[model samples]
Target: MDIDFLKSQLEDHDQSQLLWYWESLDKDSQEKLYNELKHLEFSNINGYFKQAMEDLKHASDKIDNLLQPLPTEVCGSVTGSSPEELKEYNRIGLEEVGNNRVAVLLLAGGQGTRLGVPYPKGMYNVGLPSKKTLYQLQAERLLKLERLAKQQTGKHCTIPWYIMTSEHTKQATDDYFKQHNYFGLEKENIILFEQGLLPCIGFDGKIILANKDKVALAPDGNGGLYRALRKWNILEDMEKRGVTNIHVYCVDNILVKMADPVFIGFCRTKKAECGAKAVEKTVPTEAVGVVCKVEGHYQVVEYSEITVETAELRRDNGQLTFNAGNICNHYFTLDFLKHVSQVEQENQLKHHVAKKKIPFVGDDQQIVKPTEPNGIKMEKFVFDVFHFAKNFAVWEVLREDEFAPLKNADTAAKDTPTTCREALLSLHHRYMLDAGSKFIHSDGSSLSDIPCAKKAKESGDCQKSENDDQFNKCEVSPLVSYAGEGLEDLLSGKKLVPPVQIVMGPSDITPSIIQNVTANGTTN
Candidate 1:
């Protein structure tokens, strides 16, 4: 093998370690590298190698630029679609609800570190009626959706759940779900894959080696979903399974609409290579990426890119413009995914790094907090793939019903247990009101102020409100609570319904519990 020739050709001023990397290779490995280079004689070695080196440098530069405090444009507000556009989407959604070619790609690699839990994000119980975990809710939704598809179209819907986990939580996550029997879901349909990680670099840009042969690394952000799929050969697996349309989402959002056939159907019917779920911002400055045209091409502008002037832009009717806030729910066809995955492995997409407080050890046996930022945490946004799509579409959805993210600690108040509880109760309250129940005060009289369960629980029985003519001693159960569906069934009769308590995994409803103030009862 021509070792020196190969080394001379590859040595460069920027990468002084190339010589060390070559020296680390044994004779057999050197011969192999020489053979590989000889086989690529047809390729422009100098140009290709130089470009590869420059790409890494350029990516490093992008990170340096990112360090400068991001502008307000990094977040964006939501923009509601016209009523006519919404009507059109609704029509398309209903038509596509019956298609069996859609599947869900759930990103579940995150740990509940922010929540101070030692389990996967999917395992955190939100303290709902059933105590059902996030995974159960999503799994049950797939089950219900499949049944709905069969009932609506008379065709069997096989919606596969493609879950992505990380080295940190793979074994425990799988074991946790298996022990629970996947919450009555089909085990064969659940596919799990592990994402890749890159070594953390020090402030000097040198890779931080944790041990003699291993380096400390972290999961390449959720943006690496495509590469993880390719690395695990999941993209090819999906193709063989007859899945063309993939509805992908993160697992933290409790109210996410999963494997939404309507979204898939709309993408398919419209022939879109990629599509995203978005919501109109409550104001013009909410923190989220906005979908809009960049340099005459469609792209998502991170909030930091939007200035106050850009956010304040309004239409003729004085409504704030630029209102498409990405909810992280996306749809991509197999062909398009294939393209993106290929680019991902080839390092084609632009890379951005973040500097964080990575813990380390000092000579004095104390943990060191380096004053200067060290190491780059690489992340690939799912939106980054949009730039490669031949055609992309954005669909606006109702944020109030579907965008509560379960991130942060309890005190964060964004997606904490308390916040999720409130959101769920709000949904239930609307359902109850739709069923003709009136709100009552503590004194057993109807109240003008809408009663929140947090406050209502302190008062008295929710069913014993004033002006109870609409309900007459009928027993109404949530059949499906915010925790999950198919819980307790509602029983209707002539009398107003009484307050109800729900349980799970038990067939026996103790006589002591329902013995008082109840009416007719029903079971699922």
Candidate 2:
């Protein structure tokens, strides 16, 4: 190690304390610590810390009346579009896919700590019949979508997958995909890349050391995506691959539509350089960020940023003025990415500070976990770049069909494994019904499915009696129906019952086998 250079860098940043124990540590520890310090890139930590500390005091924006609903021309929805419009959009989107001009980007840097797991969140299995991990399900959906596009355009194409990982998930995620043979996807089409990481610091604007040998770090949120992409030449790679439009989404959304044709089609139709997939908020205070114009620029404003009265503000149609709930699903044209990457400092995405109990070297000269927040982690949300879009748009999608996020374990009240599974099963049930399929009991009596559970609850009858009927939750394979399409021939006018797994063979949809579904949601 260059002792003089290391000492100079540390002294310059007021982080020489990292080397305070250097004289006492063995040569091996010295080498480890030196190497860690050598690789750090937080030269602007002081400036960022200063700004974030001020934000914590009061980062108020005066936009009470300036907020406007997403303009009509820039907004489209599955609920609002007519069948003809949807068909046309689907056709246009598939053409882009079949031409290999579309790519899917996944933001999957976070771990599954909230979900009670040590692995990456994408590796989670959400208790479906196939027991598929989030990654596998997304891979299969892409595979199915490619085939669908081919069927529509008569051109076979491979959809490139760009997964953004972090220090915590990079190696494990790479290994998991390799072990699973890329979940029936071509290895060449799947690209896993690491995002940037920022040094975690304390309230006093000093770097925190995880151990005697290392500086503590955290993934630089999803917004670090832009800088990482530029650093790794992801933009150049996308250009070479002829990927004109990119669909980016979070990994935890189990119901995410990978390389969604309709969304891409809608954005393309509107000539949108950057776009987002929004869901109408269920209620005024639903804890979702609203996608609306702030000072004439597109951005997602958090619910807490506005007053309760402003949140409850309604439009002429009685819908909340800020009803476009941000689901972190977005579309970016290649040109948009290029410009955003090369934009001036005033247009760049800014990092937000979050208080966390970061484990660090403590009083006894050992790494310790604090019971309360003791440090800050700087992060940049991917949507923070929306303000840079020259022509932005928002596509509203059905929350139940497109936004089943898996944030926690089954123990959490919402966004749990159980809730995700039920949401999927319920959506598949609706798909079956739309395909002219029916569910019946063993004796031909009509059966109630998970979707009916909500109706039953509204009618005060969700709880089962000693003799009430059990649910026949069915799982629809994505390879069979990417969005409930192409299923009429196999499932139309069919009487299905009990637990069924509707999957497709190499050529066509196979006959589903029936099994008894118990009250505990297991199949017998």
Instruction: Residues 224-295, candidate 1: write the lDDT tens digits.
Output: 787788789998888888877888899988777677655665565557888888787657667787776565
lDDT tens digits by residue: candidate 2, 1-524 = 79889899889878888887788788999998898888775567777888889877765654667777777878888999999999989999999999999999999999999988999999999888768889988998998999998998899898999999998999999999999988878999999899988889998888998888778889999988888888788989999999999999999999999999999999999999999999998599789999998888888988878877888989888998889999999999998888777647323567788999999887689779999999899998889888887688899998889999999877779999989988887788788878887777667776544434556867886655322333436778887888988778877788876566776543454544445556565754
- Provide the TM-score for each candidate, comma-separated: 0.73, 0.94
Q: Hey, what RMSD does candidate 1 come out at?
A: 8.6
Give per-residue lDDT, candidate 2, residue 430: 84
Candidate with best TM-score: 2
Q: What lDDT would candidate 1 get against the real structure?
A: 0.60
What is the C-alpha local distance difference test score of each model? 0.60, 0.84
- Residue 456 C-alpha lDDT in model 1: 56
The worst-scoring run of ten residues by lDDT in candidate 1 lies at: 62-71
